[model samples]
Target chain A: MKKLAILFMMVGILIVFPGVLQGQASLKELTLSERTIQDPMKSWTITFTQPINKGTLKKQNFLIKDDKKRQVKAKLSLSKDEKKVTITPESPYKKGVTYYLYIKGNVKSGSNAFLNEHTVLPFKIGAVPKESKNSSGKTTTNDKQPASSSGKTASSGSDSKSSSNASTSTSSKTPGKNLVKVQTKKHSHFDEISVQVSDYVTKVKAGSNEFEYKGNNLFVLYQPGLKSGEKITVKGYSMSGKVLETKEVVIP
Target chain B: MKKLKGIGVAFILLLSILMPALNQSVSAAAAPRIDHTSPAANEQNVPIDTDIRIYFNSDIRGISSQYIKLFEKSNGTYYDFPIKTVKKDGEALHILPEKSLGFNKEYMVQFNGPAVDLLNGTYNQHLSYTFQTNYIDFYELMVVNEGRLMNMLDTYAPRQIKAFAPKRYINEISVIHKKTGSLKGDQASFNGITNIDINTKSEDVVNVHVDIMKDGKSLQKGYASKVTGTKASKNQFTFDIGFSNIPDFYDVRVTVLNNAQQTIDSKIIKFAAEDGKAITSFKESYKYKTAGNGYTFHELLSKESLFADLLAESMMQDIKVQVEDR
Candidate 1:
């Protein structure tokens, strides 16, 4: 009995010791969505909700890689609040390509707790297809077919039918992909918003095809076939995309 | 020991979180200040034509519309000229006067505060300068004249003449004199004689006489009463002399008389009408040069006469008359 108890104690020590020494390093709930961008090529802002501890936060590590594992490197910088880090890819990512984000040990929580040291979070980047091909190897319908107009069938042909089904499933799985999330304070003069996806933010001028945001209320000057709660990505730098106030908008 | 390790890890994280915040505060405090304006403050005696410009130590972003104002001291009126409308040469404000200021008048330029640097949002204090307009000392008068005259040999002829004369003086010009031969030898005998004997083509003898011949064929004829007084101003004159049927060549003598009836000047002028054949031949040659082929005789003669008259008038008007300048 004494031997058994001693063995049990040793086993407990081994398990608990590793736990304590390893430190509670974990990625907080990571929120992902397309950031509103105006200029997609030059620069973009990707916002995270969780505040990072600047001291323990190591350099943000990310890679843009294709399905074939061809890797493209990216640079990252922490905002003043350390709650957000903007990832600028060394080269612009290809449209319609899936990319994986491997954040290394450097990222930390507001309490200076390191996030997942080895695990990488993966996400895909793609643009809304202006047009799709048909199985007949001929273009049945040009890109001029409006996406949401006339309630026409989303699928033009067999291949388009598959593509449409896939896009619909992907969007439904990630509801955030269709939301331009902006956080505003009640009656406050300004608010600091965050961008999470790599996209553009553009202002549709008044009397043009753009919408206006009046104190967090969005209104379209001209109808762009957009329903309520649709997503739009604006691109430009306002205080380095950490704090931007825009009044004009457009349906993406 | 496990708890201690956990605490160590937490402490490291905490330090990492606070590092960036600490660095930002330091940089914000080290931002530079505006040193001085390019045009020094309270500068005076600037030229009226000078464009006012200002410079700061650092690159600026905003220039307020209300910052620049011009004031008229005489009327105590002030007006604002927006910076955008004001031309910019580098950092300078190009202020153009709507109307030039009167000579030796005092004016003021005021630069108001709130011309803030765009990057830093720092405002400048109100600065004013008083300047006086210097006398430009340029006065000019341009005179243009168009008229006619009769002299043919006068090469100084012009259809138009422009003259510059001092406004302070009254210019005086004497009448032009026509050249003529003096009475000598056979002509001397008729110098003082008022009456001359003339033979006409009809063989009738008539007396050709005149009071005086001023020059060439400008004859003073008839009774002193018949000679109308010079009707134009002292600056101009016109006269008419009459003659009856006379020989081809004739001499007329005249004596000049003052209002007191005393002789003051006397002279005799001779005129000749060549034979009909000679006169016709000369006329034909003149016609060929001026009116042959495509030309019309009447038009050519009129044009030539008009040109000669215009040339002579221009010469007379352009002749320098002595005048005083102050």
Candidate 2:
């Protein structure tokens, strides 16, 4: 009877030892929050619950895939402390795009154990504003304002007024008052019609059909010909486009 | 008792016999023997003009003719110099330099492994040695920074110096100043100058001067200065000034004559200054934003901006590009 008892005890010890040793070898646990797609042009930091082992991380190991399992622009970088892995897209993540994050092969836990095989974290990107297209086939009006060319109609005039109001609301939120204000001025000289785009009125070349625009102190030029006193809409694209400004110009 | 005694005796004999063999094996693995070298190892400071020669005892196989490398210490960075090898006297390996080494600088020659002995199939260990070149007589002066200038000897002048300034700043560099009586037109001059400006709208300008002299006589001089151009929309400018006709035997000196000088500020830079090169110029468009996660596009932009600013300030004869993390 004593021998049987001893045999049972030995079996239990053998089974439990491996488990204890494995537990000790475990380095740390890592938890990833739901993935998010913010600004693509800007870098986004993905926070992790715990630091991960960076030694096992390689460029090709982590991947981002669309719903069809097709690969998209993706890059993985490990933090200095080996705590977090920051994934970045080569381009901005398109709004309203869904993607899956897959952690594979080279990814390892802090204890140097391989991460779960085929580990995948899926998430959807937010909706982005679609580019507006002109269905009328006459002239396409951009997100800036009503078609600057079709300013003769009352409907167009009312559209310009609403856009101008929107531009004012956007400009008030701008950080600095000295910020260059962009205005679109339309001109027409018979067959040659040109629009002048300038950040400030001072930088505009009067009657020359050439105008310059400024943002972040950078200057850009636009040349379009239109008649004098013609109602034209000017719109501004800020770094964030949050401070878009549109103004009416009378070409002299 | 008898069996136990026999076992003990056998164990002792085994240990004694294996001990010497183990010791020999460990020593052989730990320290490799130096067979022979071309110019020979532990050779005293040799001439900088001479090609490096090293010969090993074993016939080396699978050794790449281009495996040898030369490194120079610069600003805490190891800059690699290309080395060429020639087969001489049948078995000896000779490394020749495409260009003479800088004087008074410590250089290291390294042989990458895969240098194998043809006879025994044993690999030759990686080999390296450090040595200094003989000093040249004249000093070379260059502008490394707006406020900081490098004073160097002709034998030890750096291949290049990096500078930073606004896009619109005018850069003027003169190896030997024609305006100063110290340097004659016929005499060799190492004096140079560079000027540059990047902020044309702001009208920001950076002017600097570099000079080398000995006993009140200028050996090398350089000057650079720039002003805003006709295009108010364009704000950046770069220049490269070369120091030619450097005379032998002179001390080096460098000074920031003017951080920003214009015609209105004619007396901005001091008349006399000190020390030092090849002129190379580069330019790149600037972008402001972060490109991706764990990566800041700002750094790339800064590097591009710095390179463009430097290239505009110097005359670079040649440039080599190496891509990493691609």
Candidate 3:
């Protein structure tokens, strides 16, 4: 019975061996300079095992796609020897997004040999360290703070009188508990403000400028060409881009 | 008769000079008199923390604490203010109150008789002066640093003094961030504003002067034009001080000059542009003399300062490349 089982296993190995070799022969390994990018402005370098055909180095032969399957506009440059290709995005890639570099199978080497298999190389920009799944099966994070821009932009259209009253009323209560407080130091040509953020605030935005949350809850903002009595709108944001607090302070 | 007349004329001239000297000596030996007093008699809008300074014509010792008293008026009643300490510095008698005076209140300082001079000449005059405290203190010195350079200098978080590592081109960004356009024209290393809030409106002009110091030595001085007391509520005076291109530790002396160009309210702020070192010298600036340094920095090179240095270095490199290309 043991000899019969050994015979069946040998036959099974023989049946799978050719198919495994065929699968290996069809799949092409993609080569990339980096698999992960920390900078949104990072460029990828693709090296060919054999010298590539110069004519085959067309934009159509090489494609970069974001996670949404949308093609990213990129500029491609080939080395003089045609063995190295560099792909740089025209604009910065969004952080925490995955991108795929597709090299078409039609790409031919100098010897007129086809690449035989389409190669897809995946790279990620700014990886999110802690990720969890929500009820919708979508990846979500409560740990990582969103970048600066998502904080609510200050409304510039508020009535000066009402806003000034609002600001003046809140100015004295600036250092209250669990609240973001901003103190502005006004100059003739410029104004400097120090913001004391709440414990949960991750970023502070003053007018058009944005600053990361300090560990010590202090953020200083300096704006030039602001005369005294001018208004500056400061906003604090949480990790999920929620406006934690907003203070419209007149320059003093 | 001619000789006698000549002698009489000479004697008269001699006596004219002698008589004045004799009177001066007599007065000098008399009671101790106050030559000047800060927050002079009936002075309005005085700082709450102002020392009750009585400048004497001659050096005087500290009189009895009971004789030198401060009274604050409330509801038509004068209450004795708590005395912390009384100091006699050379020709000045400084009376420090235990607690800061209330805002917009009238206070009277009394030197009730027997103000003994250094030579023990006692003045029996009961001298007193009244001054009303200001509603808002104008000595708030706010140093404003801005632009890409400041952004680079402040890496981790924003702070009062933009500090940098010494000799690093990155640190200069903190001081010269206000310089826009070309580096050719007049550019200030640091720009600051001090508010002078007073109740009374006057045409008195306040001239501002900035003296830059390095290692305790005077490096250079920049002058700001006189800003006349324009409003009764607040007067914002700006100081545009130019620092040398060298990156090092510096002490910036910002002085508010009176009409006579004498230093009135002054502050000395220590700045560090070396080794990402933090500065502690800013506290020396008179807080009672002015408002405290706005938004004092605990550390110049926090995680934020590092961020500033890196950002500034990258930005400066880009600027340098752009300039070279131009």
Top candidate, metric TM-score: 3
Each prediction's whole-model lDDT (CA):
0.33, 0.37, 0.49
DockQ for every model, please. 0.00, 0.00, 0.02
Ranking by lDDT: 3, 2, 1
Q: What is the TM-score (0 to 1) of candidate 3? A: 0.29
lDDT per residue, candidate 1, B233-298, as tens digits? 343222223332122222334333444554332323232222111110000000112110111112
lDDT of 2 by residue, B98-203 (tens): 6665444667778687553443344456778876543221111121221222222122222222111212222232222221111332332221222222221223
The regions of model 2 sitting more than 4 angstroms off are A1-252, B1-35, B38-44, B58-62, B65-67, B75-77, B84-89, B116-122, B134-326
**What lDDT score goes with residue A24 in model 1?**
29
- Write down the DockQ of candidate 3: 0.02
lDDT of 3 by residue, A102-132 (tens): 7765566666655544555566664423343
* Model 2 alpha-carbon miss at residue B223, Å: 1.9
lDDT of 1 at B234: 43
lDDT of 3: 0.49
**lDDT: worst 10-residue window of model 1 chain A:** A163-172
Stretches of model 1 off by over 4 angstroms after superposition: A1-252, B1-39, B75-84, B87-108, B111-117, B122-326
